[model samples]
Target chain A: MVFKGAEMVIESLRKEKVDTIFAYPGGAVIPIFDVLFDADDINVVLTRHEQAAVHAADAYARTTGKTGVCIVTSGPGATNTVTGLATANFDSVPLVCISGQVPRNMIGNDAFQEADTVGITRPVTKHNYIVTKRENLGKTLREAFHIASTGRPGPVVVDIPKDILYQPLEETYPEDVNLQGYTSPGKGHAGQLKRAVTAVNDAKKPLFFAGGGINVGDSSKIFRNIIEKTGIPVVTSLMGIGALETKNPLNLGMIGMHGTYAANLAVSECDLLFGIGVRFDDRVTMNLEKFAPLAKIIHLDIDPSAIARNVPVEIPIVGDAKIVLEELYPLLDKKDRPAWHKTIKEWKDEAICINAYEGFNAKEDDSSYLMPYQVISTVNRTFPDAIVTTEVGQNQMWTALFWNFKEPRTLITSGGLGTMGYGFPAAIGAAIACKDRRVVAIAGDGSFQMNLQELATAVKCRLPIVIVILNNGYLGMVRQWQQMFNGGRYSSTHLNDRIKADKEDKVSPDGSPDFVKLADAYGAEGCRVRSKSELEDALKKAAALTDVPIIIDCLIEPEANVWPMVSPGAGLDEMVFCIEKEEE
Target chain B: MNHVISLLVENNAGVLARISGLLSGRGYNVESFSSGPTLDPDITRITLVCRGDDTIIDQIKKQLNRLIEVIKVSDLTNKHTIDRQFALLKLLVQPGNRGEIIQLAEVFAAKVMDVGSDTMILELTGSEKKIEDLVQLLDGNIVEIARSGLVSIERGRKHAAVSQK
Candidate 1:
């Protein structure tokens, strides 16, 4: 039977078992949307902007372990997704973004909404295709999905011209893809694995350094088992959060610039660093020369290039993390490093004191301001099992540090790109992917406004996402950096309308838009929280709402900074602790 | 260090862009590049000459291998291989200098393809060093030069075939 290119797209998606697509429509994609209008099997989520659509799809892929899908029209619609694609590429999220293009004849003619979609997206995408013929639509789509979801998964784009979608075609979805050049490592080399086991056995202090690849490779459970069998302490990169339960005593918090003092010290002092599914990004390996200086690093990852890229490795095993861990588990011998544990315990205690936040005690101190830590902790407490997403900057750091993520895929954030305004839309995606799980997006005042338009999407879908805006009236992280390095020249970090207001004014007229009112305008519930008690009450109220999104604008400390920060280019051990350090 | 890399890639639209874009985007220096279809119509072979340290070259090869279009990546820098380049030179053939340029071209086995009233276009296919010598021998008389970058292959039965591994 002959079918139109649009039908082939839907059929291809159906064969892939894709149930939802986060998308935005425009001039170039009217025919596809026309077909989607009556399509009941596929749920089309119409986000306000193209960027949000891709971000939502990326988060959806993260939460469900499925290849997320999104469709955007040509030109600006396609370009807007660059940040989202780069975000997914860096974190290795599997996504298929379909972009509508001008007609084949008009593609390079500078016609209306014409774009070099494939060229623009080549670097950010794992691979991309421009379908000039209707006959190749189904096969190209199958290839897109296959490429996106396999072997260190990443985003891929398929650009179909507008005329191609209207033409008739004989369609057949290929059952299997055969890309000779694209092969993923499945098993570790026996020789290298043996050497790694030997290193693990010989070390007095061994550390497990985990990254997002563990989650993307679906090896977290095996990873935790490896840690359990070896009795080794672990520290994670930001994207590696939730790979090991925060409840695990041996699981040191995130290890990076804003990593826990204990985690950073452990990376610095370990005799052997066994990294699984991690590339050792510069953020994690600050001052690479001094990073893990004493460690004989053993690295295992699915991507061959990731090894020895940043830090040198004594043993490099290139393979899928799950398969590698399963093989290594039998070779491992349990160790009892009493002396190393004692040292780590002292560091953990020091970290706890440095990270201590005055949660729910501001009333006793006669302070009316809400702290960022307090707001994050309260939300974490209120929804203990909720899926948490965070916008970049201080909000992200606080959530990464304070949220007790006990399961994999529970904390979703733009770890690699650090894209601002990613959380709310990502929370929307997470909510849609897992309807039973409560989702919360912790955003900053500056970051929240970046994609606040997605509130309409959340409301339309009736997603029970609680967006907690820690409104600090300034670009908190940048302001903190300016305060530290730029001689207190706040510059353009201030977001408040009243520029002359004292920087200390906790409740002074906050910038425009009034978040609560903005939520109301979008038909979502909204409230303001000032003190610790108000935040708790507002969170409780938000938790009860199951059919609509709720915006909680928690007025946090204006000058609050994420502490224990390692200055850029400094060693991980050179952390700038908070003022509350225990009397030297 | 300078290295020559041979790659077998799927003959597809935008394959070249994906490769060159990745190299340039990563700040790897591409000194020279040439690509053409192999014996198989569906496959194209690209040879690129790049300059980098050992670590940088290692990463460049891995990154190239990561591209879906690339079928095989073979670094011929230290391998026993045969390398050749093709060039078309337009030389200024003034009445007096024509014989001197012709003598230099003949020594390099260059073919005198076309001779106009005042210029000579010579076609040469040989090793890069041979081409360099011919250009050096007639440095001032040459008006234009278009040289194909290096194309290299393993010397013996060892081939960058897809099924070899």
Candidate 2:
């Protein structure tokens, strides 16, 4: 059958089972949008900004096990997706970004709205292709989707020139793809499996350190079997939260800088650390020198470079996590280390009794305002298993430090790039992917304003995502840095002028926007919570709503900073906890 | 440890740069590399010799396998692999020694691709050692010599797929 490139793209997407696509249209991508108008099978969401479109697609990929797709125009639209692509690359999320490029003849002569989208995204994507011929569209799309979804999945870009999209060709799709050089190892090597099993069985105080790979590989059941049979406690990375149930005796909470005290203590004291599919990111190992100080590490990962890149491993096993775990499980000798389990329980109880929020007694009479921690902990208490997404800065750090994520894939935050304006759209995508569950986005006022227009997208999609804005009036994280290190010289940190005035009039009566009204205007429910009681009540109500998206504007202290942060140049051991007041 | 890998890939733009960039981005060390079109007009052969331990080499092979343009990657370090290199030597042939040079070329089965008034370019295809032997024989009388890097294949009937299996 003869078909145009745009029609072929839409048809190929349908064949690939892609039902929903987040996109933003423009001059270059108009032809594809025109074809999309008649494409009834696919649901295309129009986002306010191109970045939100990519981020929403990324979140969709993370929630569902499908390859998320996003379409955008060239130049600025393609550039905006850079941050989202980087985020997905770092987190290894599967995404296929199809960008409309300027016509082939107009490329490279400084054509209007022409940018080297493939060159720009090369560093952040698993692979990318620029289709110069119309006949290659079907093959390229199939390959892009396959590479994006398979073996350590990541974002892939296909830059389709406008002229190529308009060209006509006889549609021929390859029934099967046989890549000669590309071989993803599907099973574990028997030799490496033997070495790993021997290392695990020989260690007395072994701990399982799992990462997002567990969820991606679908090896949670195998992980549980290994832990139960071996009777070793497991400590997860942020992405590894849901590999095993948090309440299980064998499962310790997340381990790292802001991890539970028990998890950190176990990591520090354990004799053997069995790291599975987890990269030793800086956040997980606060001080690489002192991290797992007493533990002999055994690293198992599919990516061979990651095995010995960060932490030196005693035994490195390069294989798929699921296959490796399955092979390693049977070799372990059945034994119960009751005394070690008891020690872990004691540490957990001590952490809960001492460092937990319930132990903090705020001065009731002061009533200055609610702290960021209080708001985060309240949300954590209300919805324990809700999928939480956060924008960068103080809000992101606070969410990391305060929220208790029980399952893997539930805590979807931009850890590698830490991009601002990621929360709202990502939450929308997550909500759309897992419609049965609630998706909450915790973003700062400054971060929220960057992509606040995505609220219209959320409203149109009826995603039912609850957004919690930590409205601190100013750029809280930067302001705190200035106050602490920059001699209190706050330059461009204040958002007073930015928020107070409307875009049309420079000097409006009220400079600040009523976010509640904005949310209502977008057709979603909105609420303003000032006091602690109001904040708690609003959160409870937002969780109960099942019909539409909800936004809660939370008023917080402007100068509040994320604590227990190691000052940039300082040693990891020299973390600055809450400031201590001097005795008069 | 250093590994010599010979890859067969489709002749396409930016494929070499992609392979090199992937190596450098991951901090892997590439020592020597060369690529040229093979007998097939559509296929190109690339020989890359890299330095690193077994882990690094394994990763390089795996990552190379992921590239769409690459068809096959073989580590010629295995004892069963047969490798060869080709070189052409241009000799300044004196009238008094022309017959002797032609006799030497015939003895080695080297074909004379180009003949000038004073020079004869002999094309010799064989293992790296054989080329080195020919170069040493005509070192003093040779005007110039160009050598193609190593291209390898396993000696046994088994191919990469069969070996891997």
Best by lDDT: 1
Q: Candidate 2: where are CA atoms >4 Å away?
A: A330-334, A353-366, A473-514, A517-524, A544-548, A559-576, A579-584, B1-5, B23-32, B39-42, B49-68, B71-165
lDDT of 1 by residue, A408-500 (tens): 899999988899988989999999999999999999989998999999999999998999998878898999898888877999998885223
lDDT of 2 at A307: 71
lDDT of 1 by residue, B42-151 (tens): 99999999999988999999999899999999899999988899999998888887887788788889999999889999999999889998888778888899999999
Each prediction's Cα lDDT score? 0.89, 0.80
Task: Give the top-scoring candidate (TM-score).
Answer: 1
> Model 1 compared with the native: what TM-score?
0.97
Error of 2 at A424 (Å): 1.2
